[model samples]
Target chain A: MLKAFASYMTYEFIGLDQGSRIGDVLNFFIYDTIKIFLLLTVIIHAVSIIRSYFPPEKTRKILAHKREFIGNILAALLGVVTPFCSCSAVPLFIGFVEAGVPLGVTFSFLISSPMVNEVAVVLLWGLFGWKIAAIYMVTGLLVAVLAGFVIGKLKLEKWVEEYVYQIKTGQGQQVLTQTFRQRLQYARWNTADILKRIWLYVVLAIGLGGFIHGYVPQDFLVRYAGNGNPFAVPMAVALGVPLYSNAAGVIPIVYALMEKGLNTGTVLAFMMAVTALSLPEMIILRKVLKIPLLIVFAGIMTVTITAVGYLFNAIL
Target chain B: MEIKVLGPGCANCHTMEQLAKTAVAALGIEARVEKISDIQEIMKYTMSTPGLVVNGKLKHAGKPLPSIEKVKAMIKEEA
Candidate 1:
């Protein structure tokens, strides 16, 4: 449906030759912009409503006192639905520890919250197919779960900043109860807010994709980061660590890279590294995690994400 | 009356601070609204960012931030 509309607009309305490169690029750009924005709005609204049910307070209660592996899995899954912001990282970390939620479980939540977010999922689904999106989600969860469990087994709890454990988050925290109408309103506002923030990135991504599709040679990226290159995955991961961006913010670049013949695994790894292993996040987490633990966390994430990238490249 | 909005100065915290000020004005109450961005001070009250403390009582905390009307009601309750 979108393709037909885009075609109509590019060829009939704009009076461009149907076979022209510009016409094809314009069609792709229009179709993708409409489809992606629509998908983002609908998915974000739905996810927001679902999120309204799983606030951090409730999540902390759920993860508290759970066993190690089970807690890790649950925390990783809960990370998907819970609303997380870096600003709240300190309090959430302290609150979880104080609530008796295990350190590893909290790490699981922390890792997956930013990595496997709704924005990334929707963008992946919109740009690639559902299979790629599903794969990204599963791999992301596995990385979080395994990394957290490893951290747990290593007995790194002592490495956390002592102040995090010392701080007693006062009891009897007030829970805001909202009616169904309020939830809907909140969802609407959240959708609008997210869209407003990400629209520019989406346009830039699609525009880049369109430009690549129209003007850039198909084999341009293949020459450097193609499947034959063994170092592509690691190189991508290494490059992604220094760059900080949300999932949505990085999708356009990912889309362009993929269009230029970058393998699925390398691109996905790049996306994960960019979103999950950012230096700024490490600095923020420093308030709760000690230097050693932070370094270990970064090491584990890089290795896991790099491995996932290579695995996808080999198989897909 | 004193209202303190607790956060690390994130956007939501700012919004909550604005809402508190607007609520104070709407109710025509003589209330002082303050934003506490210091992590230590915020942690002392609640672990959640964008927390609202009305006259030293924790009123609300965390996301899906309350609307202006709800903020007003919370302040009125404290009053």
Candidate 2:
């Protein structure tokens, strides 16, 4: 009797009982919140702690001191370790411009930072094999580096707000002093705050993912977006422009979509669209960059992500 | 120890913060963590909140939590 009662309670808490018609939706929302919470509290915190050592202001100085090509390369490398999120895009943009980093190089860093990260890499490795993950990383890095180089040659300096030109470079490094115990506390609190902010986005993304996971028609996707579909790659690229979110948020969806028969190229295109040209990130960028620069950036990203996606689909 | 996570409480920042705590707990370290939601305060640290500072030194920000061993090493080195 006791064991049976406990099992019943568990179902009730998870809302898995047969009588609960809302169980699926509620369960999904709860699952997402917890997943986002765990991700925020643990994965993101560790990354930030490491990031504290390599401040953006310092990165700008280092890159500025190097050759243009080297600067672009180093910037992409630094992007992997730095703490650039959707929210910080505008300020970082200002900081980069003020520090005299070329616009194209900065764009490369900006594009890569969100589209690829350790978390996404690890998650992708777990979901797919290492081959796909490796392909994703290499292709993503290439897109960012090449796009930035191309844009750099075009000289879109006029697109920047005049105020950005006046911003100073090399702000003094800010360091926090704390014992091991204290750093832990800082991490915990940040987790709570971050989870609160993006939990909804995570849930919505995951919920759509779950539905696709449970019920998307695979044959249709294969017929339309499979390796053989010539038009699928371009179509996927165009579609990525309007949808927005970072790589972290989109990778899971990619996994779910792939499980439902989505092709690698199509998934890659979606991931790029959502990562590099996120609507939310762009909206945030609007505060600093003009429409022309934003359009150009978006257009370039769309073409590159599409091409890469198709190329990977063909090769891998 | 003074720790500051800069952001308006986005998911990534939150995860980084949480993982920091988990690392601390697993390692048996006790500490105080502060969350900075205000844009002005965060701007004081390169406009990056969800940022981590150990002993008045900015150590990490922007990405998710790293491996526990690495974080433990960083804390010990700082000490």
lDDT of candidate 2 over A1-316, digit per residue (tens): 4434434444675547643534444454455445444554567678656665566777777776455666777778788877566777766777677667788888888888887776666555645657777877788888888888878888888887776776553455464455667556555554555555555555566666556644566665677666666887788777767777655567656866686677787787777777777777777777677899888888787778888887877776
Candidate 1 chain A minimal-lDDT segment of 10 residues: A167-176
**Per-prediction interface RMSD?**
2.8, 5.1
Binned by DockQ into CAPRI classes (incorrect, acceptable, medium, high), candidate 2 is: incorrect
TM-score of 1: 0.93
Minimal lDDT window, size 10, model 2 chain B: B61-70
Which residues of candidate 1, in runs, are more than 4 Å off? Answer: B11-15, B38-46, B55-60, B63-79
Judging by lDDT against the true structure, name the best candidate. Answer: 1
Lowest lDDT 10-residue stretch of candidate 2 chain A: A1-10
Local distance difference test, candidate 2? 0.67
Query: Which ranges of candidate 2 are over 4 A from the true structure?
Result: A1-46, A169-217, B1-45, B49-79
Chain A TM-score, each candidate:
0.97, 0.75
